[model samples]
Target: MPTTDTTTTDALAQVVAQRFTDTPLRVGTRTSPMALWQAGHVADLLAKRVPGLRTELVGIETTADNWPGDLAELGGKGLFTKEIDRGLMAGQVDVAVHCMKDVPGDVPLPPGTAFGAYLTRDDVHDVALFPAASPIRRLEDLPQGAKVATSSVRRRAQLHQYRPDLRIERIRGNVNSRLRKLDEGTDGFEAMILARAGLGRIGEAGQRPYQLLPMEHQGKKVAVLPAVGSGVIGLQARTADAPVMALLDELSDPDTAACVTAERVMLHMLLGHCNSPIAGHCVRTPDGREFHLRGMVFNRDGSRFVHAAAWHKDPATAGSLVAADLLRQGARDLINATKN
Candidate 1:
């Protein structure tokens, strides 16, 4: 990693000017603490890699920031991404860091914008946070009609398939709030499903008294298949934004990029969104060129499911191709059951 020389005003000025050249670069992110941390992490990595480069972090608020309403009714995943997109298009920010899962299946990036450069992913499994009875360890142990809270339609739809007898309930707010709901028993939620990575990030994973039942997606266990871009962080820049794009390239992880590319492509092809129980996972083979993907869709009630797997040449568009194949094989009907 490169370090900047900040010894003197003139030296710093010269260093900054030389590093940035004539064009300044800015990165935009959501206003949430996690978003800011993500932005700062990117900024530090970029600055360290490109000595003297002056990068500004801009915090922009989006619908998810202002409204506490249901995420499902938002219709698109853009609620979390559009603000940054606008910042890029308006020249307010040159690049943006995004949690890829929040990006919709079909994003109309402005003509000049492009996505590349991803950080390594984190744990993608969903953990169950329960309060009493340590012996009630896994999903099977939860009594019938046990109330499980989650906001994701995806989780709700899938959980129903496994334990239809278990009561599913809605939960809003961030990880901490949901955990508090369970611990305090004020929210009537016995347990809440949350991504283990999110909990670990906040340093609350160990404090929870409940056991984590690893989540599975598309027939692949969470430990085996990470949600598309689950631990990866993405940087997007305008195609014309050479300086920022080059900086991002310096921070890009080859393996992470390859996997997310395949995953996002699969998602884009399937038109899967936050509301869909559709899930996908992609992994790179040891040789680093080949990729494998698993995709699945569950009936609205989670009583039925379709699974597909595919292998692809270095790129791994096979995931999307597999999803398309599944859709051709009654996935549409199973998914449509949600509307009924």
Candidate 2:
């Protein structure tokens, strides 16, 4: 066997770490509070990993951030990531941080761009927030025909399925704006559903009094499921940017990467679109030997749906198995119906 090179490898790593400290890495991201917090969090991680390394956040206003109308009508989730991706591709920024859920699964990443890392996952549950004066403390506390607001079709569908009499209204904006709207009684929204991770990132999860909507359906304990990649932050960089990619490799959590990869694969295989009411979640077993994936699909009104789950040693295989199972249960018909 060839002799090991402990000393040489250590020296090389020291050199690589020193090189990054010499030049600040430019990280592209949206201007929203949650987005800025996410970018700052990534920078903080890199700084901790490579002492003295500097990172600059380049905030860009995405179309989705500014658009007042429906995201589905504005061309879906890609709007949230498109400009930042373009900045990265044009060499204007060395890295781009994205909420993995916003990255479209129906299409491939832009040419020359690739995800460099997925940070450790965060809380995946959705929470219900009511106005300060409202008495509603949980989803079940809402009165019949109560109005609720959310931006995602997936949430809307699930809410309808959970409470058929509830009136689902569309609300869009950053976390702070949405909270303001809810507090001001804008559009008469009695409650709103938001990702718990997002609220945590923006420092509101702990400050606000909110109820965790049950992930599983009431009584039956069947999962309502979260959006694919809901709580993950993905770092994107040009494929040719070797040094950045190398540094990002240090930040990647293997377990999170594996689980999120499985969810994304399932979404891609299902051809889920912006309007598609689809949800998938993957988690590793406590023993860390296997992965489990659960997926759900619903029609526009949530009247019909299908769900499947599977476990495997390989993450991709687990996702494939779940996708296959959902398809067999008529997931395709539900997905296609949403597109029309």
**Which candidate should be chosen as best, given lDDT against the real structure?**
2
Q: Give the per-residue Cα lDDT of candidate 1 at 253.
A: 73
Worst 10 residues of 2 by lDDT: 1-10
Q: Under the 3 Å rule for N, CA and C atoms, how many clashes does model 1 have? A: 4
Candidate 1 per-residue lDDT, tens place, 259-324, comes to 777777777776665666776777777776678877777766667778788888755567667878
Q: What is the Å distance of residue 231 in model 1 from its true position? A: 2.0
- Estimate, for each residue in 25-95, the C-alpha lDDT of model 2 and write its tens digit: 78899999899999999988877655666788999999999999988888899999999988998988888
lDDT of 2: 0.86
In candidate 2, list every pair of residues with a backbone clash. none
Overall lDDT per candidate, in order of appearance: 0.71, 0.86
TM-score, structure 1 vs. true: 0.84
Per-residue lDDT value at 36 in model 2: 94
Candidate 1 worst ten-residue window by lDDT: 217-226
